[model samples]
Target: MNPLHRVGLATARHPWRTIAAWILVLVALGGLAATLGGELRDNWNVPDTRAQHGVDQLREHFPDAGGSSAQVVLHDDARLDAAVVDEVVAELEGSEHVTTVTPRLSEDGDTALLYVRYDVPTTDTDIYGIVDPLWEAAEPAEEAGYQVELGGELPGTATEIEGRGELIGILVALALLVIAFGSVVAAGLPIAVAVGGLVAGSSGVMLLAGLMDVSTSAPTIATMVGLGVGIDYALLIVTRHVARLRAGDTPVEAAARATATAGRSVVGAGLTVLVSLMGLRLAGLPTYDAFGFATAISVVCVMAAALTLVPALCALAGRRLMPRKVRRLDTSSPSGSDYSTTERGSSTTDDTWTARWVATVARKPVAWALVALTVLLALGAPALGMRTWPQDGGSDPKDSTTRAAYDLITDEFGPGANGPITLVADLDEVSPGEVEALHREVADLDEVASSTPVSTSPDGRLAVWDIEPTTSPIDEDTTVFLDELRADVLPDGVEATGYTPILGDISELLQERLWLVVGFVVLVSIVLLTVMFRSIVVPLKAAAMNLLSIAAAYGVLTLVFQHGWGSALLGVDHAIPVSSWVPILMFAVLFGLSMDYEVFLLSAVRDDWLDTGDAKGSVVRGIASTGRVISVAAAIMVAVFLGFATESAVVVKMLGVGLAVAVALDATVVRMILVPATMTLLGKWNWWLPGRSSAARQLDDELDVTPTPTH
Candidate 1:
């Protein structure tokens, strides 16, 4: 008669009504998304950073130079004819929102970069609409035997997800489900629930975009997270329901009981994920906010579907949620009304394998715990070497137009051509002589590749210079150069902003704030876990183990993406610095997800410990009950996350790999070895609370099971 049980019972009793309600909700939301959703735009504003202030100053003071610029790289083996240059300029200048097209030829005149300035910012224009026209306008140059590649705001601003990656991931998940459940119908239930939840979640994001800023990347990231959690949540509830059916409970009774237990854990796990995402907002970037909002909305919908829809569908499917093999073993099962609680965790109960494994670990708690700690620590070693920067368009696939443009420009102008820093000076505070002196000094720096003559505003309130760095945008050398410019070169009134500096500021800011995020999440999460389980040691232990899993995951990310170890297989051809935002974002997300698995396992262990005071025996039985489910659930998540690694975006690819690695290690090493061994070592002390230790032990003393249930 718990709330979860009541909702589950009501849904199961009125299965068709619940199904219809979900259908209506989906259809209405999907239609609204198709009609009212706003487009996604990149919000790279890093508050309180010099780059952000410089951008604001530029936009406010220098109207002509304020607009975002795109590049049209024209390469020719022969001398570039004036006529071809004029034609390309005229073509681009005529496009919508194009304010001007300024062409600069290389010293040899064999290559040129056309700075196509737009009247509006990149976010304000129809990006793809303008891109197609730019391509068409440059077609004449290509026809005249000039190789033209458009970069900057053209393809650089577009965020496209690879549909194939998700498709293949779902197919793989289906295969795994079938193998686990041994029935296509049973396998399909989790898939159906996940897809349904994803649709609702994605649509919700689109609708929210109409109300708030949502990045194009958010929905995809949300989809990736939703799919894994969705299937895992549904799997937990469905498995419990099937077990109830085998115990001679009717469909409604089975659904209610399953929801009472596994559904409660699903809710807890889902809420933990949502709470952790709140840390992203503390990051102080709309990009991070969009990510948090989209993913949080997604998790809510999926959790709701798992709690309500899973029960409704179970009732509709009746005994079909179980495999044919499972049904064959359930003789004289209740048809529609009987209720039974033959055994807790009968749903995920595995064979002698899990029991034996638990026994083996419990027998040598110290050794097993030490071995797991060592493995996690070893895997986490590489994280110490991880370096982060915002992944530039240079990291795109070679076939991409942005990459092509980047290469052509770099080859012609120098590495600095791809990473120009803008110098913004307040004319009201600085005289013309001072401005010229500043430009001259900056141009004379060894790291400065080239500096354009200072462009002063017509009203004489601002002066700007386009200064190119000798190194690439993500280069460590460029970071030092920027630091030197800010600390040693630039005067008080002058500030820096542009492709290189903005990304540099973002990297610097995110890295500085990373500790703040980590501290906030860890502290808050420990409190939540303690409140949820009512044990100080349990939450603290879970936190420590979660850190080990996350650290190990970071190490894998550093090796694969940063060190280029097997990065090519993940589809990123060369080693690139980790994305500036990846570590903070990864910590926030994975910490929550790691805690999710912890809750799944610990919830069961706690429930069993409460029922039986025998700590070691509870650990053994808990593993036997939940080990198979946790392993299978982790397998499903690994497959899903790995699927997203095939995405074209470097950030998405890195996230996919990192999430997959963390879940894999969390389920196997942390859950299997560490949790059981540590819990056994702690024994009755594991349940000790500030004021309830004596009472908890007195409530029950005939206890001995201790493996946490991983529903």
Candidate 2:
């Protein structure tokens, strides 16, 4: 019996139950989405340690100092007049949100920059909400001849966040699916599955965020990744079912077999993906940890939908889903071949490349293993010097408006002009002498080019300072300096608060937690693989090989994107430090994707082995039978990732390229070449483990089905 036929039969046995459960799940997810309605903030809000400490220092040193302010650029040239400035300042001060307003002149003498200080911290969501009204109030200033432009990080980030990337991502996904699947209905199926998965995944992320301090970036990551993997997995199963139906199985039979075989493959693959993502929790960075957890949840949901909901839909659609003409086509043999002898018996019985490859492996397993091992080692060499840095502060791609603005700032001012570090401090019982001493200490620091004391709270509990660093804020050295200040400079007398300080602390914490995250992932991978294969040796081999492949991929990324060795050829500028999020994100995504091929290939091999009890023949036949489908699926996935690289964002580009490279490598080198060679080398040992005889027999019984001999 074909796997699709088995799937159809199984589904038929309890159609109502499957349908009812899916409907309930969908309804619950839909309700959650409706209620959440985009209310969640897009990124995590990490408070700034430096800014807090700076604020404290200022309050203790300069009691009369006002609060930190944002310089709003107004368009009207006439607002430069004293009368207009005075009127605008009075109105701003009168506003409930604005604590003080001071107008300053640009060197050009024609523009006025209003320094408006709000009573609340800049991270406060209410400050963002009030911006529109503030803009409205400033409109009269514009009417009086001033143009208003908000220029702070919070305002800029808020605006960008409002321009949600969801719609674009959806359109891209739909278009790709339609083109790849070549049917509106087929494309829609994957989209539907992805939507459900995304909704569920998003809800999971929200719940997690409510419990822990998670980066706002995690949800967007979950949505993007869930959709990509969901659609890819669905395409694999649906296409296989369609092929099976064309092979002359009835709709119900096709659904059953497809689900049983492809469904099983998906389950195994999904587990691999989930486990791989879970590995990211070992990264110890909150951003990566949250990302790993969120993505793992999404992958699980998507897998569930693909294995169950998809099969149910196929069962319901029956023959109607395939066009009448497609259903009528003969599919008893290979679609366009005339080798009668080759087509007879089980699909794996024929002499094929897989057979030839298996014969070679059997004859010279040692030689093949050596060759594969050498190639992997050589490829992974570049990873030794991998550098991790934030990709956010670099110049945007040349064509982007943000990049243009960034360039204007950098060229007119300097490299560090684009991103300034905010230093904040908490003030309690610190004396004025201590406060002044701290200020002078900061001013005299080698990295600190300049410092401006901004405000002192009326209660003298807080003060803020803006520090201009000699290097770009994103520079490693600058980050190091920030770390030193947080760890060594500040004592019980003052507390620092700001994004830079928080980032430094997080970086150090991530370094300490790195090994734990790695250990956790490896342990999980071992357990999951062991359970799935019921063979300790096989799981160990698979994990070792996967680690090698990942190392090679990272090496390539480091060489091209980090060291700037070939970035120009790849159409990117100077490489920034690989974002702190990249390793965990890449590990999870690559691991999951790699597992897709692993399960697909391994399942076929296991099936052939069960039927013939000839290990070599089974390995060859399995590889040959699934290789074409795996290649096509991998190609499509790579295309999707590569398309994402076209975006101007550097982090997104790195992610796209890295993932695409890993998938391609996994599909070809790892899956096709290394896996078979390594398994052949292991020989009978691949199934070595205590109690394995019974487990192997059980797996064989569960997966085994009567092969339909093509005559």
Candidate 3:
């Protein structure tokens, strides 16, 4: 017996024992997570970069300037009560986390702003928890008829958005499963297995989190990918088991065969996904590495469940997995009756629609291929102009305090007042006169809206200047201005170390390293596909197909999020630059997911080609066999991704929309249409590997005309 089948048989023979062991492990892991899980921090530690170097220098010489700062904005139609202003300032200055507080009054005295500096980085998980004191201090202002709104790191780190997105996604997926598989028992089994896998996977991530810097979003992202693939993998195995049983095999035999066939495909597909995800490590970014590890763990757990747990459940349910009426009909129907091969929970076995569709596509392979290629190119065109930046409070909800503070500041002062770029210099390494001269040059530049007087550290070894740009934080002009300062205006020893410049530096780093990451992902995928399909042409073609679909997804994001095309439909109020990390993360995830359909469809097609020695017929038959399951699985994934699109965070929405679009295009155009059309045109060349014999080529001429059973 095959290894996959042996595992399935052993689990099937002792379902209770297997299930009980899994439950015990889950409980133990959950307890460990509750007590020992480490805190997740958004530490953007991109090494070997100018931004990090500047940060290090600031921390060493000017700790006050290097620490994170929060803004407290107070506005009143009349002059702000002087005593109330002092009270808030005193409250902030009295906090243990606060290192310093500086107050600024607007020209009319109607608005007051306080810049409060903290000892820790704004992204530290500790910051979010210790903000209650500041909120308590602001209550006096609110009671005195003065509107108080907090901005900057204060509001950004205050509270993380909590949503029921995953739960809602699961509910939607279950509905689609019932519609596809008709039998409540059969549909429920996949859901149960998927949820179990998710629990195990999430627990593993928690255990790992206890030792490393996992982002708070890691669990949600892991859950998102795990649930969709878990259900889909289990569905494939269960679908195969039902077909084998209907063919008159005993329960144990049917489970074993299903595990051998679909189970193998599941393992192969899961491994491809894992390889693509693990390729993120090549980017040299810890954030991507954490993402790769968490998601990879989830994929492994689900694949394991599909091999063992799914088979165990199938054996226990036996023929009763179907509705009683449908079971009786399927068992009693004659050989020619439709019920002999399919009933409830097995509607996909009827390949009439898929077969006819493939036949139509085969007649005009060239035309269909060009049509899909053109659509993909058109959708991806906008990506040429895509811009990236860090999202700020300007994109926050209109009613939120952060947005209000940002608006008030922009209305009264310049837009750059919300995020002034700081200039830090070590005067001990250079003359104070030269530092002043550099400051004068910066203040005289055309891009300068205003500049604060240069201030020195307590020992006078360090000098700092806050320079406001003429444009907003997200404006391209701010980046251009920083470039000018670095190239010509600033002295050799002076450096820029503010949030705006640091963010700009990180963005540039990502842009520079983007190609390297892409190369790593494509190379890994090619090697994996070449070995799996046993054909050089198939791997190259798979790479091209995945790239095209991913390009199309990028175009969709550029149009919808960057160009404000249909932005209102997705809860976005205005156009904003794409997040810097979106492209790389999306590429890794989309490439892995795209390969899933490729592996499943080609695995079945290759099997048929070997058995029948007919290239064109095998192409058509392969699509007919796997099209329904792939379509259903893709639909479930799309729903899961789009559910996250409804989230409040802009970054999460971008990821959700991009993944949903990519999966949809891959399933319909790439898998159903392009793969068959291209294979038909390629003929025997599709399967050619090096050192093939003439006898193998000659066998393609002999066709097997026997019709394949739909199951």
Candidate 4:
């Protein structure tokens, strides 16, 4: 029996059994949630390539130096009185984590900046723990007649990471559901299913994070996507089932039929999405690996809920779930078709558009294929010259008083007033003269804007230097300059260690791994497609189509976000180097999502082809039948993603908007027009395989052999 048809038969025969099974599953899931707690981390640890070079310079020069520090800004009155400054300084010094506190005046005399040095390590979680106390101190300072503001890495990260933003996300989701479904009850049901999935999925992530060094960012994104998508898929299935019931089909009959059709589509779509997410593991970046695994797990959980829990809910609600009274009023006396009669005849095959379109496609395959290919090529043009950088310059300068103060300092004390690089050099048995020569060599590099003299360790075994780079620390160019220093400028005897060098090494590693990741994703996708379709030609064609979709998305990203062509309208100004990890991440995510719609459309076509033996009719019918569902799913996902884009963080915004655009384009252009056109051109070649002449025939037999319920 086909798995979907079997599900329908089982539900129809044993509705209570299905409901009982899901209830037990829900109980266990809830119990699991109670035992787990949310695990949170604040830092992204984006490897800074310049850290090593800066450490080398510091070690060769200033051995006694500490690592880089962040400045804490204190917002105060316009006058900048001496008492206020002294009071703030004293309060900072008395704080538990404080190592040193220095107060400085803005040139305009409107703000006082406090550079607070913490004794704790930058990587320590304790740094975030100090934020509340720091805020407490600032509050007293403000009461003492200064409008104090605490701004630094710790403060900024703490503020951003404080809550899950679940409430806001849920509220937004509800609003979108109401707009999409036009029923409060209908909108609420999907949210309930999604929340259940999210709760269960989040616990899974937390447990996984404990077992592996996963990126903290993964959970946040996974929950958002999982909840939104879970609700979307569930809504499609539930709505279809309810519509059937309202049309007068018995509750059991409606559930059976809906499960057989929409259930198959959901499973296909979910598997496609899951496979794509798993593809991210190929990127070779541990962070991306973590993201892939976490997201894949969540997707699986969502799929389970959509398949099981949603059906159970439908069975339990029975006919009451549909607004039957309202539906009856909406259907006037003129169209005297009784609900039961209408529903029985409303099988997916009854739609005339599906048959008519299939005939047209069967007649003109070549023309449609050419048109599809041309459209994809046009959309993919911008990706060819796409360039990426590290920093997405969308942060609010005003929000970070430290950044604001840094801006003021740059205006008054020159741009070099920003943090200096810490260079660490390990000395084995090298003489002072050799060390001095190495220092001179480094100091002469044009990229080294300025260098301070070396400071030796207490045992004279390590040396450190305070070297300032001409470019900003976060700038890609500065990392490149640091790379040149490490590879070309470093003397043979000295080994450098610091923030900059580590960042440089990470960048090089990422660059090297890019192709490997892409190859892995493509390889996996091809294999999965082959297994699903049992045909070499179909898999190859699907892979080609996916690549084109991804390339087009990348091209759009380059034009709008990277090139700053429409950045202003998007509320972003800084042209951030696309993060090194984004391309691989996008490839995995977009390919998977695109494949989702592909599978949903193709499954229907495949089914139809088996039943009628008409290739053209099947493709056209499949596209027409699945088109509405895919469009609705894509619309909900786009809205959810676009909501995330409103966040001030540039990376989140980029990811949100980028995914939104890709999903929208794939749903409308690729799935609706391009896919049908291409399929028309391929004809029987679409089912071709290298070694098997009768593969399509075999597939047809397999489809036909599957069990069907006796109506």
In the range 1-711, model 3's lDDT, one tens digit per residue, is 567878888888888888887888789878888888766665566677666677777777766557677888889999888899999999888886788888888888999888888887766666753567777778778889888888886576554546656877788888887887777777888889988888888888887788887776777778778887888899888887777777666677667777877887898789878887887776667777788888898989888888888888888888876555768785633333332234322434477788888989999999999998999999989999999887788877676777888888887677888888888787767788888888888888888888999888777778888888888888888888888778877666677877788778878877777788789888888888877766889988988999999999999999999899998887778888998878887888888888888887887788777666789988887788787788888998999898888877777889889999999999998987888889999998898777767676445424422112332
Clashing pairs in 3: none
Candidate 2 or 1, higher TM-score: 1
TM-score of 3: 0.94
lDDT of each: 0.83, 0.63, 0.80, 0.64
Off by over 4 Å in 2: 1-28, 36-38, 42-150, 159-216, 239-248, 278-297, 315-380, 391-393, 397-414, 417-431, 453-464, 483-496, 563-574, 690-711
TM-score of 1: 0.95
Q: What is the lDDT of residue 694 in candidate 1?
A: 69
Compose the digit string of candidate 1's lDDT tens values, residues 1-711: 478889999999999999999999999999999899766665656799998898888778766555677898888899998898889899988988788887989989998899888766666646542577788888878899988887875557764676865787789889998888777877888889988999899889988898777776788888888899999999988877777777677889888888888887898788788888988888878888999999998999988899999999898898777778667773744544332223443533444677788789999999999999999999999999889999877899888888888888888888788878999999788888999988898899999889998888777888988988988887889999999899988888899998788888898889888888888888889888877776799989988998899999999999998899998887778888999878988898899888888888887777677666577887787666777777788899999998988888888888989999999999989988999999999997887878765656565333322212211
Q: Best candidate per TM-score, number?
A: 1
Candidate number of the best lDDT: 1
Candidate 2 lDDT at 511 equals: 52
Instruction: Please provide, for model 4 over 235-258, each residue's C-alpha lDDT reduced to its tens digit, 9 standing for 90 to 100.
Output: 767766765665656656666666
Candidates in order, TM-scores: namely 0.95, 0.78, 0.94, 0.83
Cα displacement (angstroms), candidate 1, residue 540, comes to 1.2
Candidate 1 lDDT for residue 358: 79
Worst 10 residues of 4 by lDDT: 332-341
Better of 1 and 2 by lDDT: 1
